[model samples]
Target: MTRDLKALLASDQTALGTWTQMVAPELVDLIGLNGFRFTIIDCQHGPFGIETAENLARAADANDIAVALRVSRNDPVEIMKALDAGIRHVVVPNIETAEEAETAVAATRFGPHGLRGACPCCRSGGHFIRNWDSYVTAEEARTGAIALVETEEGRRNIEAICATSGLAALMIGPFDLSVSMGLNGDWRCDEVQRAVTEMARAGTSAGLPVIMPVFAPTPAECRDLVDHWRGEDVTTFVVGSDKILIAEAFASWAAKLS
Candidate 1:
């Protein structure tokens, strides 16, 4: 069977994913083969067309890494296209209410699970390899739906959003949240910390893992991030991304040259 993140996280194991902002499917395979259990294609900020995103998803799956498409907005088409293309998990940005969360979750499901349009011809559904019943059931079993609540309104509605059904995780877009609170880039402010902890607590209360992003550039920093979130109970995040890794490597090379 293909690697499934929802299945893995169900066992209380950490689900480690990398974010891709560039259009390279090779990076997905490289990170997947190395250690990352999943990849989140950044359609929101990245220059990703549907074809490229689909190819990226396929490459990650080929390498046994689950794929999560950080979709563009909360639009159903964006979510639908990602799901139709084989991405099993979706992290939606700027969701601020339970109703928005409900819509996002509904887009990921069909019939009793959600109101997603049915079509088995997509690559993710094996290009109609399975019957409708089997496909829907299998997809639902393998899929995870996550909501990114980054604004203060989202912060206030955290509990209700987390409590939404068919929603698997509540994610923090830290920088956006910081900016929303007028803290500039100073995400270490006490207010930011409090908001993050509130999100974690709300997820815990709702029986879901709180998705976090740890932007460490070195082994030591990654370890520090892990230690920092240890008390939060939930364990999963986009640990780092190609941009950070490449930036670190480039800076080291520049230092050597200098």
Candidate 2:
């Protein structure tokens, strides 16, 4: 089952997770076994497609960890495909307006409330074994969408975007936002910090969990950033990524040998 990270965050719990660009299902199992509550499959920047996402979703379920997909863009087709592949939690990136927010949310839902196409036989629906009523009910409870605010325009419309209904959370994309604002990816810039604070506050006020990435190079720095954001009511975080961790470990081993 998807771990229901949305519900966990709504309960005011701090959920920390990592990102994975590797196309291996076993990698997701490892992340879960290591005690992470969730993992985000970086489909947008990574080489993940629908098939790979399906396998990763299964791995996450087996390990009782929520698997979130960061779609390449805020496209309904891509979002719908991920959902059908059993990715219950989705992070749509580059959302710059309320309409984009609405579109992303709608793609996660079925008709009447959304525009998702029906696929009872899809993995998300249990391959048609589960009754329609039971399946729809469970799907409603499990699936959720998180909009990523990564650009200056997104920051400007943060309030309206957060106000969109059916959003489970908001993700502050620090690096992209900084670059978009002409800071050249300097997320530590005072202006970037201000924008991040405003966005996080808006999402919190809208009753949505706000997720921010802690991209520090050391554990101490990561803790510092987490503590700072915890005071801002942004409890959910992506502490790091599998790629960075692997590279860091390899570098540490080489340094020790040298």
Error of 2 at 10 (Å): 1.6
What clash count goes with each model?
0, 0
Candidate 2 lDDT tens digits, 1-258: 577776667756778888988988887888889878888988888886878877888888899987899999888889888888888889999999999999999998888888888876887766774577777777877888899999999999999999998888999999999999999989988999998999999999988889989888777889999999999888888987888777877888899999
> Which lDDT values do the candidates have, in the order given?
0.82, 0.86
lDDT for position 133 in model 1: 79
Q: What tens digits encode model 1's per-residue C-alpha lDDT throughout 41-64?
A: 899989877789888877886898
Regions of model 1 farther than 4 Å from truth:
none
* Candidate 2 lDDT trough over 10 residues, lowest sum: 124-133
Error of 2 at 162 (Å): 0.8
